[model samples]
Target: MSPIPVELAVDAASAVAANGSPRKTFFGHPRGLSTLFMTEMWERFSFYGMRALLVLYLVAPHDKGGLGLNAATGAAIYSVYNAMVYLLALPGGWISDRLWGARKTVLVGGVIIMTGHFLLAVPASVSFFVGLGFIAVGSGLLKANISTMVGHLYPDKNDPRRDGGFTIFYMGINLGAFAAPLVIGTVGQSSLGYHFGFALAGVGMALGLTNYVLGSRNLSAKSSVVSSPMSRAERTSMLRKGLFWLALAVAFFGAVALAGHLTVGWVTWTLTVVGLIIPVIVFARIRRDKDLSTDERGKLTGYIWFFVAAAIFWMIYDQSGSTLSLFAQNNTSSKLFGFNFPSTWFQSLNPLYIMALAPVMAWLWVALHRRDKNPSTAVKFGIGLALIGLSFGVMMLAMAAASGGVLVTPLWLALVYLVQTVGELTLSPVGLSVTTKLAPKKYASQMMGIWFLAVTAGDCVAAVLQQVMGDAFLSTTSFAIQGAAALLAGVAMVLYRRKVRALMGDVH
Candidate 1:
């Protein structure tokens, strides 16, 4: 899950790719698209590169150049870090609109991200946590704005080519994701050590920054100008609000420390509470909007169901970097063809599977659509949930196969990733497509923030689930529990799909 939700900035349509000097279209798109595509490709390379190693490095023994933390602690950190990245997108968008424009924000964010990775190259606990913080904040600033910049490439919001262009750009993201684990995992999990692997991630960000500079000429100047410059009164209020929150955070941490509850696990759960609350507040505010009609209210009700379903789906799917990565290391064998590979290489499977499977699924759906027989959105989500749940059930079988204490074959995990990819194909695109249409027009821009919050919420609950599993985290019971939750949700969706569709109004 290299960031969910396809809601990029739609308002930047006024900022088309700078057309001049008799330019050519890229794959029938604006020439500037190539620049953005590559920049994003390298940026994603940086992101997924570090993520693949995060939990593994944490739990690895210090003698092996690792932190030696337990699985619960490591997974907790990983989940909250991921949750925070998506959580920050709300403010990231606000910063883009009010302070620096997207272009500057993205550039600064890239530099901060690069600094974070470089800090990660240093092998110290303090550096490790600080590096994670920098990456989260920097990604917050960069990820949202960079994705939004894609919308700037198309001159018209409804341009026939816009969807195709977004599809292609998305492929660039997957390309980087697919390649990262193989490269970073090999180095980090190998004799050269984890720090070197992290350094390589820094180099990847440097390459992304280099690409941005090379492509700067073709970028949107419209992003260089703030759309809604904040008034002085608003600025004063924002400053006061920021100070109040900052002081509150300091006091909260101080109280936690005085209460003898200041620890990684405790902090992680606290952040989880914040992550869970954000979407609730956002949804409540949106529901209270006076502009929404009765029809819009109906769609909003349906969207809530889909949101819950999406959150559950992501809770399982996005565990690849945390629990699944550990399973690959501690439970699954790394041997293949007389050579042992890095367990982290398993991280590459989802994106690679996505690249290979997406088109096949697309063709299948479009073919069915031609006959007007494609599954409804609710059914698609149901099918996706079942597939992912079945994939975890397969892992239960793998655990049974490894009952003799012999590590299971990588193929078992591969089978799981492949099945999950199929499920992803079934649900993910439909989720994005439906989200844009489900929201009221007044809140269209805010929809991206809310949509991504689904991932944030999922990651938060994942932290909760993983922490509560105790020693069973790696056992068949854990698999059964996770698989059953999804299966029950899928069955419910199937049983009530018609009602779900009806609540969606005309959004089919």
Candidate 2:
């Protein structure tokens, strides 16, 4: 918890500014940060907007705006979609690094996402499948790189504000997430709502893309570390040969086998195989060639453990989009502020809570650190896991209060989200900045990709959990067990914190 040395902090800041960002804080930080902020805000708006409606659209009666799919199928498809979105970070990172650079890849990703939303806007069943595919691919491309670009704005070592900057960026994510459910989820679930909401998500992305383009003046130039040296023409040609063919292959395979239908099992295996191969090779090569000091290697090892622990946490928390959303629709009493809240809109509670909690938590950490009593990353992560577990315990309690399928009050749902958001404040942004700090320079993007792969793994597990819980247990019971498991895992990590810290070297 010691403040990073001034020398190391300055070094980190200079590294981020290597792409020609101004040395001084603009509007309290780099000017490009706001541009990235707005871009990500709208991007999340689009994603969460679609996500809010995804399950409801599947389970709602056919005449009343849904496809009438059962909970299991919808949950399965939702899980696979979520998992693939994260898994796509591998290719997405490579594309940004080796072909178009981050800015161009972001632009291209926006277009694809908008197209996907448009496809979803269409009423035909075929368009629904097509739209989901587009969104998945587009999300894969945009989400990872945008975050990487934020890190690129800062150097890897010693910048205390790097963690804080990611916290601010994390705010943008929640802001969009907060808005989407209120706007798109409402419109999509009501009569004549689905198409309107889908179109709105698309337009949101279009505006985001436009804002980035117009605001390019305020941005730093591409980081040469991530940008390929090839000219635009050469890079375009290479991308055509590589990504286009790969896309075609994926399409061919998906169409012939897994296309249109929700192939949860297939997507999971595909991503897992890709994840296993890519990270092992990337890390092995980095370790082989990079003359990293013992300290660096130790930090990297700690990062690996942190990644594992965080993945388990995400698995329980991410059910908001799948199992939790379904519970809100089917079991929760939705009346609030004298209105019948749209079930999908309840998904906003976590982000809304985050917007309120993040800054407070930030200050608390600083205060704790100042007192020389701040918790280690491992301890915070353990707390995160326990909090996640506790969210489910609340759900179980709510279920017991409701009695025999009676609806639980909206307040109960709100409390669960509140706890989860606090846990997120402890874990999510902290993990992001820590990963950036701990990863060796030669393997930063690859390590980030691996972190994302851990997320994918978590989503896959959540999906399987959702499916099993749907048939075998009450929703609250399932959540309770998952939460307990996460809490225990977190406690285990805390008990092992000294060893983990030793392995990680001097993260502080």
Candidate 3:
């Protein structure tokens, strides 16, 4: 894809007067896209920085400067927290489209996240939970809307750079994610390292927020162009409704979090209830939407299937945050040439691969297009799931090599990451673009919210996977179970690829 030209930047502002799409150029890509890219890069740095420390810190001995939570508790908390973060994207997407506009919503989210990090910097137990709350809410707002802004950058789906644009945007995500664990995780896990890491994450977020503020003019013009005027009463009504729902969501999640300790029955019931509500609501809504044609309805049904398949993939995949990280620390020998690499450092591998491979994927698509051999996005997604499944099996094989109960070599985990990165390249960015493409135009942002919901559900299910393993670490049993599950799910996705493609119709 060609970079945006200098002349386009001048023309963009000029065209604004005529109420048309603006043109811009800086890095072969539009300045607006770059602005979003930089903002996301720093935000992810802060987020992943905290994440890299979370599991390790919880399991580390208090004497070693950690929280000292048991593995199950830590995994559960991590899963719920991450789930809520993505779940919040639903409201985040709604507000961006209906009320605050994407720019303002992102700014608000950044501030909330920064505040959460600052609270985390405080060492008290009280502050820990408070900080987590802020982070979840803030992430919910920022995560989904930022991607939506990228779609707004291109007026048409046919633009060749659309895929490249999403790839560039995804690179920003990996850039921050790649750096966080190496930098922030190092500080937080050390003696006095935890506070330092938390502080650093906060600083990163502050920088991101600052960037967003400064770049607002360059980034938000698209939102400004489409924004409709809201009356005072409508604004008030929206605020009232939003606050009510926010309060309710918090209470509901809070109850569930607390209920986990009450009884197994309560937790099980809550999960069952939450799971049933979605399908019920979706079915009723579909029955009511008279405006949809048969094809559109079929498309929606395909999305639901994708969500199910994606949830299964993510449930097995998200173990990197907890189960996988623990394996690296306790079960894998990191020594290479007499130097032991930190377990947290392993977290960086996937992002590093992403950084390295994104350009290749972009180029491959271009090359394939030139040859008229381009595969459908559906094919790519299926391939992605299969690769992820294969990655876990790679880890299982590594465990098999440790049949004597000795720590496995670190190279095994390295290979696992390599495979996972290849899988991510196939699915993650493509899925984001697919949401934009397959969605009905009327509910573009809302459909994105639904997509995020699938991701959040996967994260929540990951907790179950972690709990089922229960301190087993890299045991052969645990490895086989998780690996077989991931592998089988991936295979199923591949087999169902034809049906998924037919539902997607002509989406390229």
Candidate 4:
């Protein structure tokens, strides 16, 4: 797409800044904020919409227009899919920095994602796997770059409005997440074939792309520039190497599929190993970089701590899709006020709570910051872990009450999600903001990708934990163990707060 005219760009930025701060436009932020807000809202609608239906579609009987996979296998597929989505971000970010600029990468990623969803809307089995692969790669590209663009919008790292801008941006994420299950879940799980729901997700992505294209002008100019452009010789050599590996990967997977060895378990275990290795390699590279100053290295150390803490939190949080999702479907009573709701709809609760609570939390942060009483990011991470543990504790209680074949009330799960939402509010947005702050300028997007790898590691761990524990996930024993572990981790973080703060140098 053509860049926005310089005169118009200048005019728009000036008009948005008329209130003395550019941060004060479009609901007290830049005009570009509205563009990103809507674009992400729709993108999330597509992503979460597909997620709500994924496991359900997998486990449903073939006659019922589903794959009919067993629960364990289905969960494995879900985990692997999620792991790949975030895992590919490492290369996605690298490509954006070195070759395609963020703008072009996002555009290409959107089209690829939309294509993936549309392919899934087809009823064939081969289409299903291909579609998933497409979406995973596409999301890896879009997710980190879009977020990096949001940070780019406010050039100043210490811009007082930065956190608030991120929170507002987060609201867009939750908005899409909130509506996905309600709209897509209802349609997809209803009498309309599951593929129909998949189609709707594609439509949502198309709208997002359209919105992005129209508002491309409002985006910062830097977003369109390749951060580290390559020379012609370097580009040619890199392309050849990438193509060779791409061909090798396709052949290897094709061989596995033809040999009937591409089971869900195989995919899960393979990616899990790769996921674990990637972060270690990235961290080691960062640590050994001679270009990094002492303070930068120190901040890098602090980021690693935050990374570990966030990964642990996601291990518990991501169960919402796998173990928690199954629990809602099979163990919780869906009836309320004489109407039986779809179990998939329960997936909406976390985002719903986030939508309601995000503004309050955002306001709370700013209010506290003004008084110089805002909690440090490390403290917020601790609070997040504690809240997650408490949520599981509540779940354990519900499990006990529902022992002996009685289904627990759906309200119990909702309550769990409510508390978890508070924990999410405390950690997620803060994690994103701090990642931007702590990263060296040369590795900004890659660091964001590393942040997402935490989710990948967590998802992989959750899948393995669920499989090993088996029915324990449905019992109080498992809940108790998880709850206690999280609580202890939270306490540990709180104790280490001072040391981590010191490692962070001047970063707040």
Candidate with maximal lDDT = 1
lDDT of each residue in 62-175, candidate 2, tens digit only: 788667777866776787678778878778878887767887788788899999999988877679878988988988888768877777666543456565666567667878
Over 186-269, each residue of candidate 4 has an lDDT whose tens digit, in order, gives: 899899979999999999999999999999888889899998899999989988998999999999989999999987667767
- What are the TM-scores, per candidate, against the unseen true structure? 0.93, 0.83, 0.84, 0.88
Give residue 449's lDDT in candidate 3 (0 to 100): 74
Candidate 1 — which residues are off by over 4 angstroms?
A: 1-21, 158-160, 258-260
**Candidate 2 colliding pairs:** 16-155, 254-259, 389-483
Every candidate's lDDT: 0.85, 0.76, 0.74, 0.83
Cα error, residue 357 of model 1, in Å, equals: 1.0
Give me the displacement of residue 13 in model 3, in angstroms.
Answer: 13
Best by TM-score: 1
Number of the candidate with higher lDDT, 1 or 4 = 1
Model 2 / residue 209 / CA error / Å: 1.8
Give a tens-digit lDDT track for model 3, residues 1-508.
0111111112234234345755555455556778888899999999999988887777777777667877766776677677778778877876776678877788899999999999988877568778988999999989868877887777766665565666677678888998999899877766666867988999999998888788777764676542654778988997899899999978976886777754433453354345435634754586468887777777777776667766766666677877778878777887887996678888898888766666677778778989999776666767777777788777778777766767888888889888877777677667767777877665664776777676667876666655655666446676666667766766766778788878887775
Worst 10 contiguous positions by lDDT, candidate 3: 1-10
Residue 124 displacement in candidate 3 (angstroms) = 2.0
Candidate 1 per-residue lDDT over residues 120-209, each given as its tens digit = 999788898889999999988987888788888765678766777787788889999989999988888888999999999999999989
Worst 10 residues of 1 by lDDT: 2-11
The positional error of residue 220 in candidate 4, measured at the CA in angstroms, is 4.5
